[model samples]
Target: MTCLFRRIRFVLPTCLAGVLLAGCAPNPEIATVTVPRAAQHVSPAARALLPDPNPPYTPASYQSRSLAAYYGHMQDKLLASGKLRQDTGQGVAITADQLTKDFIDIAMKDEYMRGGSGTMHRSMDSVLRRWEKPIRVFTVFGATVPPTERERANALVASYVNRLARVTGHDIQMTTRENANYYVMFMGEDDRMPFGETLKAAIPEIDPATMNVFKHTPRNQLCVALTFREQNGSPVMGKALAMIRSEHPQILRLSCLHEEMAQALGLPNDSPTARPSIFNDDEEFALLTTHDELLLRILYDRRLKPGMTQEQALPIVRQIAGELVGR
Candidate 1:
């Protein structure tokens, strides 16, 4: 299975695209009321450079609220990026069984979250948390990228944010302001390695040394994008970093944008078995799929909480997955 990172971009239905990107906050229209229809499933593009599990997961060192605030931020985001496809399909017909099967396979098993640098084995407790209360918004910017690349990056990211909001019914939004907690940026070749310093400067919680390893390690094997975070003990992801190789072909660039952006939302691991998904190493689909969207919906559902074990979450996941079908 040579995952092909095809060149593709699917245009959203005129009405839906307008509604999702319709207006700004407060009396929110797109994220609050709009629900895009689920289209049929289609097979698509290939691979991404997923983050290897390094340093492993360790319980946070004890710190008082004042000190923790001074020393740390949000919880860790699983780093996952992807290969892309020929086009963004309308969507797939994801039935209840398909939904549960894919969700369980992705959510319950350790194998699904495999990384390259080291093996990451975890208990079920980590699968649970999400942005239950906090704001979910992102702003796109440039690194060494020129105006044209920045513009293209912003547009591609905006499309996925709309798709993510509609599919999951979460309050995810895209903005041009400085308040965005999640930041997606395009990095030109010259700005690549040093971009980690830029991230550390903006959000001091990020370890600059780790960013160095991340940027350099992936370049050796192309098609890798990165999504890191500044998170505390809770499952809620506060700040995230998405970096795309600015010089990639439009298709691969678009592909990296889709995977890294989606992964930052909580589905951070890549499973080889995740068919028809960008979250898999197989690179079966370059663009995000209906199955992946349902996973997003399940993750943000009010019934589920952050930091739940597989033992605690399976039943609730099934319940939510049941209602999501044919909706």
Candidate 2:
């Protein structure tokens, strides 16, 4: 089974244009906390490139520290068991046929479906989704995240943005919140509830069930991404939000970043057969592998337009996969 926390919702709310609204009411407690300038580690060059710095962060609560320790221990155990492999080339060999099948499974399916009651249910069905517009990512740090960690997260996200753009040959860049349609938020335990309110304000169409998941994400689930399409049932995505827990250790945090951001790009489901790939739930790869990059290339290829059903895109996918693998 896939990781329960790796959520992807393709929503088509009535208010599409207001999906990324401005002027969210700030939480008083969160607004009062501030980070000291000396605590920040962002270099001058990176500072100029990144979004405006977050307000001074509050110290982590005892519960938050305990949770971090638990996650850190879990990561160490996984690494010791050789499960979370960072080496992309270490996995099983791949072929054109396998790539084609994996693409259909990962790119053309939904992991979670929203019912009429707004509750998310686990269901699988073929659906082609991809962004037609330029992807502008904005990062938001929680009040409990220290400045040094925020700097590291910002740099990691910025680097990954460039990497994805190169892999897909698409226009993807990091931007300020004002211009960004994709929001990548790093929320600590203390920030989750308050941030949910902010999200509701920014996205008024956000349903109660979705807010419940965000505010009370299970501990086993580390991160999630939700993408929104136009109201007319268009497959082209216009907005996306990815939330990464601040309690994760460096490696796990980076892993969440890799999978969630890439999933938001369109490959929203996991397949057990996907080897050397982060899209699988086996935790075999902690980073985006060579095979995963090929998947992204295929997804964004000009020949395969967004919204093409699996039956319609399979032949083209097979041909493209063959060319990619030199079959």
Candidate 3:
């Protein structure tokens, strides 16, 4: 099969969706990014503890129509999981040797489609025509963490931010640093497994020290928020609370602290892949933060409270800024 209908122009930012559609609008238009420090191959005592993947929010772009019926109900659950073979050839053509192997595996049995990425790499590439499908991604982090390594880096940043914000509804920035010590090489083919059997086959009802692989990062005092659509307030939480009131003014604000961040991330915040639920559906509206302040902002679309007017919020502010620092 062969297809190419390139027409994507996402824009969102009308005073951060009027402060999440109802926080009483106003306050947004900040957005910044710069997390770079943590190379030298870690281990100087875990590079003195790591965390800081650029911060200063403004990263939102979720598609709709109920996400095209949730990507055709996840491609009819990977073609009815009969594990491929329903004439795998045509049905979505793509000659040129499958776009130079730029992906082609439509689920069949989902092994993250041979390599990594998910949604079986966009349902084997045929570029998801009409029947609906389009997935985007953005994952970020950083931490050296404190409070005596706060229960294994906040239970590995709350089960890796509830398993990548349930597959990427975007928004979950955490930072904290001094020296550094990062390394999350989860390649593929079970990528050499054993991070306690990959968080117990993706958080099987937690408990294992709340699925701990020797703790990572997590404490508190960090800030940033977003992930609400049709809510009437949220240009990524008015650009992460207007950059935590101008450059992290000792950030501190918590609402759904999920049982005190799962008891300071000792783990088990109802695991089953942790929280968020395998991504998309606008990733169940993302936006989360913590790990000792300064970074992970993200905003735009004027309507910013305290009397709005940043040129009415520069045309849906969004200009890339993902920096989980190092590997």
Best by lDDT: 2
- The top-ranked prediction according to TM-score is 2
lDDT of 2 by residue, 1-327 (tens): 112223244332221110001232121000000001111122344334543338578998998998898678767866765766787754578899999999998888655544567676665465577788899898988889999999999999999999999999999999976567777899899888876765643444456755676787766566766666643456677777778889999888898889888877888777888988988766778899999999999999999998798899999999999999877
Give the per-residue lDDT digits (tens) of candidate 1, residues 5-100: 221111111101000111221210001000012211111210012121121222322322232232111101011232234444335455676666
* Residue-by-residue lDDT tens digits, candidate 3, 1-327: 222111111112121110111222222121111111111222344422322232223222232233324334433433343211222122233222222121111101111121222122211211110001111122222221123323443454456555433433333334333221111211111111223343222212223432331222111112222111211331111111001111111111111222122111111111112122111111121223221100111111111221222232222111211211111
What TM value does model 3 have?
0.18
TM-score of each: 0.64, 0.82, 0.18
lDDT of each: 0.47, 0.72, 0.21
lDDT (Cα) of model 3: 0.21
Tell me the spans in candidate 2 whose CA falls farther than 4 Å from its real position: 1-53, 90-92, 111-124
Candidate 1 or 3, higher TM-score?
A: 1
